[model samples]
Target: MPKKSLLMIGVFLLATTIWAALPRVSNPSPDYQTQPTNDGSHVEKIRAVWPGPNPEDRVRARVVMSGEDIIFEDGPTSQVMNTHSIRKSLLSLIYGIAIDQGLIDLEATLQELGIDENIPLTNQEKSATVRNLLMYRSGIYLPAAGEHDSQITDRPAREEHEPGEYFFANNFDANALGTIFIQETGYELGPFMEEFLATPLGLQDFDANNVIMGDPWFWPSQDTRHLQYYVYMSARDLARIGAMVAQDGQWGGRKVIPKDWIELITAPHSDLEESHVPNHLYSHFGFQWWFQEETGTVWANGYGEHFLMVDPTHDLVLVERNFSGNSLLSTARWLSSGNKFSGSLWELIDTHAMLVKISDS
Candidate 1:
């Protein structure tokens, strides 16, 4: 091609890309309002803070909520970040939708699918159920052999649990699906999710480019953009999700997820502490979604420190974007310390809300 032609083509593509990147000026759900709907000018931003003793380890993050901007030199609001295991939250939502659509039967046993303890699970491990898998209560333990077969299973980003616990993580990815098949399972997790969940939810952004465009467009080596891969989401997108879930899987009354099914999934299935939540809060977990006791609040958390909290009772959604993979354990140790990572993020919101309420009064 001639140099002039190439240059014109490049400029045209750049302009198209920039135009496509702009947020759509469409109406939000009538049930929910954008924080700064018009003007788009006073949008709040939060900053990520080190929040620890390690000065170099601190990451400044920006936070954006219902329309208010809270910027922390220490934190951030709109910067897109990976949603580690929080991806599981979205996964469960997708799975629930599939089941609601009659595409999957939660009660179905793996044995019925010819998934008997074969290559993947031994005789002792075949008792797992799809519900059990979603609940992280499966019988299969992290495969031994020292993660030698790590990239062989359909594990999530990272799961911290005991042996015989249906646990898996995206880290190191010993459970990479290519190596391990979903034997002794009712339905193949990957193909099923790709067809039912990813295809339904707006996550087409993640899978579409890869599936349609090979190699350079999609990283064939890692398939890193896969759903199991930490998803990159924006604050507004996350809020939209929160709003969707709040409406019981209905987007503008279109029945995105079966209404009855959404209620079933959000309802308390097990105590959260039993699943590793805190005692002070009546944190409970169901399927993949988590719940709070008095707060009736639930949240989805991602690694590298991200939280998407929804308080339906208050019609409030709070999002905190941070990086906590390095200091995860440290946050646990210094949780009592000022601004330790754990749930301090919530306290920050409560503090702000209280101030707002007082101002209103």
Candidate 2:
């Protein structure tokens, strides 16, 4: 054999060995046998329109439900992936329960709650109430864990507005809510969610142990005062959450979340003009939820295309998950790209269009 050919063969063998040695995380095979009745036509229509033409909008799983019946499901619906900012909406639900139990007071001021930060909060900033945090109107701007660069850049100056006087999609408010919940309720977020929210809704793929405190892979050195409480949930499990909300917080005839709490959280607290969300489709902001009153729909959106949409008018719930894979290479690429690797606006628009069509049918 020629020397060049032998060298090429040796190089190929070495590359193959290295590739085989790399650790891989695999999504569990979907259990098709136990999957609910799926409408083939609906699934096909969704596939044709959703995720759009963006290469970054890699949708990993989707599940659509009408009432208690799952009408469509695709990909690994059982695989638990990061829920990202949807954790905020989950926290809202937990707050509802805590408030009902008299464990948390919405009107309690941050000063009274002892919510001090590393940089120190102003007296005016400390006057913000728990309800203000839930509405993202806390008006305290500080570096927060799990925040994107755009969010940080767009954040209003510290003490720009008094508490409850303005609206901004602030991660500081959400993360602080996590702190307040733990302090007032004396229950860690994960176990409390698993008990009060997950188990009640019959979530099949939720594990309290898997809940993360911060994005260790990306923002490892974020402020320790208020770390983001990240939740991991399967598409199917998220669908269950959407279903309960769609049913006015009722799950199988039992009131899982208080009806008044549901009504209050879904009500439009901040108008589009005030909230300044980039998406025109969402007309208002509720307590950690986006509201489209025209369609009578509420949404919980997370980074990288994770969504939980509830349409009470049609009794429909839709969940979409985009897992960017857990490989070190993927994480490295995400970090290298300034942590801007997220789902496209076009994809979200397309998803909304598809949902409208499916609901109409």
Winner by lDDT = 2
Q: What does candidate 1's lDDT look like per residue over 51-92, in tens digits?
A: 222454334343333322222212433434345556567656
Q: Where does candidate 2 stray beyond 4 Å?
A: 1-59, 327-330, 333-361
The TM-score obtained by model 2 is: 0.82
Q: How many pairs collide in each candidate, listed in order?
A: 49, 0
Locate the minimum summed-lDDT window of 10 residues in model 2: 25-34
lDDT of each: 0.46, 0.78
TM-score of 1: 0.56
Residue 17 miss distance in model 1 (angstroms) = 26
TM-scores, all candidates, are 0.56, 0.82
lDDT, residue 248, candidate 1: 67
Candidate 2 lDDT for residue 256 = 87
Best TM-score among the predictions, by candidate number: 2
